[model samples]
Target chain A: GAGVSQSPSNKVTEKGKDVELRCDPISGHTALYWYRQRLGQGLEFLIYFQGNSAPDKSGLPSDRFSAERTGESVSTLTIQRTQQEDSAVYLCASSPGQGAIEQFFGPGTRLTVL
Target chain B: DQQVKQNSPSLSVQEGRISILNCDYTNSMFDYFLWYKKYPAEGPTFLISISSIKDKNEDGRFTVFLNKSAKHLSLHIVPSQPGDSAVYFCAASSGTSGTYKYIFGTGTRLKVLA
Candidate 1:
């Protein structure tokens, strides 16, 4: 089966530009998540979507960061007015559903803001 | 604050030897812990996990041990292989139900010498 996957393996954008990272979760996965991995840093939770419930956006670092998921299949993370600080690998993951423990991750989209 | 911490930046083990990776957490609300392995240019794959109530969980050659009192956990791989060289991440979550807000630690790079 196909695992989670991300598009634009690498993105080089200028500061103040907006970029969208896409993610396709595994089939039948109802829970999806987004995280950011900065250089020499841990993965920081960004947002989460489970079934039809309201998405959890508590992890978004700033108002410029946001994410959306269509039902339970695909997700996208968007950064408005990108900053150099936003340069990092954006990762997406998914699980079977609520109460599921394991989350399968995507290769990630490396966003480089110059 | 760093809720989870992987103290060792990297570790090396000879093939056919034991490989141990350590992680610590500062949040008492975390009830589930998971380990993930990632190779270059690839996504992270779920390895093993342990519940807060349990002290240990084993799966084939992989085992996860949790010390809730010390807020610590470790992943042990027996007969480490050269293919096992990659980054290992430790993640924790507070609730096991609807919310999938995971706190991850900085990954530890592992090298297996053949």
Candidate 2:
């Protein structure tokens, strides 16, 4: 893991329950990303993976959002009925698929819902 | 719709000076550009990047500037410190046919006031 890693750093839940959030990337990093940061705003991508395949989920945000990744190195982002604007923070990143390169982050998870 | 826009949410430099941060994009097919730095719950690091055939890019104290005819881009942090405050994001990348991602902006919270 030398870098990206995310999990229950914080979570509240109440609105409609249902939540899951996890990410651990940066071992050979074949892309992988997911973002969402509300409060002060900025960063909202939501999906992107390469090795585990996910050309780009066009930035979820509906259908209760969804995400998945496998051997490419753990990733998960379900969020079924949660609301309260879905709270904030949930970030995770990794890269090395080249092209523009540079990404590597993960210290987030802070959903709230309530 | 919000391709990328950081209309200044906050900024207050002082420690040593120079903090400029701004970004705007309407998509000219992007062409790659980046600048990130967040720190509250962590997540978000990469700090400089620019390539649209290059307008400018630096590292040390950070510097990035590009203006693809006005799509605009900026980020300069000369001496400003206080650990450089935080929250600064601006990203854009397009590369369609072969697939690519990254699009962020809605941050600017530098405070650095030593």
Candidate 3:
């Protein structure tokens, strides 16, 4: 893909089910970030990855929200036991080694918790 | 408390008019600021950015103004077009606590009328 790619553009899951969203960032980019935006609200930072290491995970809403990245490549955000409040569009972005570079975004994975 | 804030939830502008979107931040350590535009079903795309050293930056019809003392910033689009209709987001970063991450605003939706 010429730009960032996300899997299952749309997902509908039951309240108690677990769901995993995937993001494939631009090739050669070293920094990847995950974010969530609920309807009528702004975007919230979920997790950030730099070359496979996650030093800051403070944005995760709860222990149920976990993400993993494989160095500048693919990233997966897993939600354990979805809830109604978990519904939102999960976005991913990649840039060239962080600091001051423009971030390119993916189409995003829309998660709808039922 | 939100480190980055966009007070207006929405804005309306006629084609060929100017569209101004504002953002405020409480963090003084922020060294970089950026603006992003997002459309429905799509992720945000980087529009423009400014470093703390400069108070104003412009690209084509889009200009961004920063006020360091007031901790405020605004984006202006002269002669706004219908295509410019979308949600604009403001983000700030002083460098992640360790790895340098950005903080994003809630977003302001702009409706450009023909």
Top DockQ hit: 1
Q: Which lDDT tens digits does candidate 3 get at residues B1-114?
A: 899999999999999999999999999999889999999888899999998999999999999999999999999999899999999999998864544477889999999999
Q: What CAPRI grade goes to candidate 3?
A: medium
Candidate 2 residue spans exceeding 4 A from truth: A1-35, A38-42, A47-57, A61-63, A66-80, A83-86, A89-111, B1-14, B18-30, B34-50, B55-74, B78-86, B97-109
Q: Where does model 3 exceed 4 Å of error? A: B96-100
Point out the higher-scoring one by lDDT: 1 or 2.
1
Off by over 4 Å in 1: none
For candidate 2 chain B, the 10 contiguous residues with the lowest summed lDDT are: B94-103
lDDT of 1 by residue, B5-107 (tens): 9999999999999999999999998999999998988888889888898999999989999998899999999989999999999999987465757889999
Which candidate order results from sorting by DockQ in descending order? 1, 3, 2
Candidate 2 lDDT tens digits, A23-77: 9998987888888888877778878878755457878879888988886888899
Error of 3 at A54 (Å): 4.0
Interface RMSD of 2: 7.5
What ordering of candidates by TM-score runs from best to worst? Answer: 1, 3, 2
C-alpha RMSD over true interface residues, each candidate: 1.0, 7.5, 2.0
Model with the higher TM-score, candidate 2 or 3: 3
CAPRI tier for the interface of model 2: acceptable
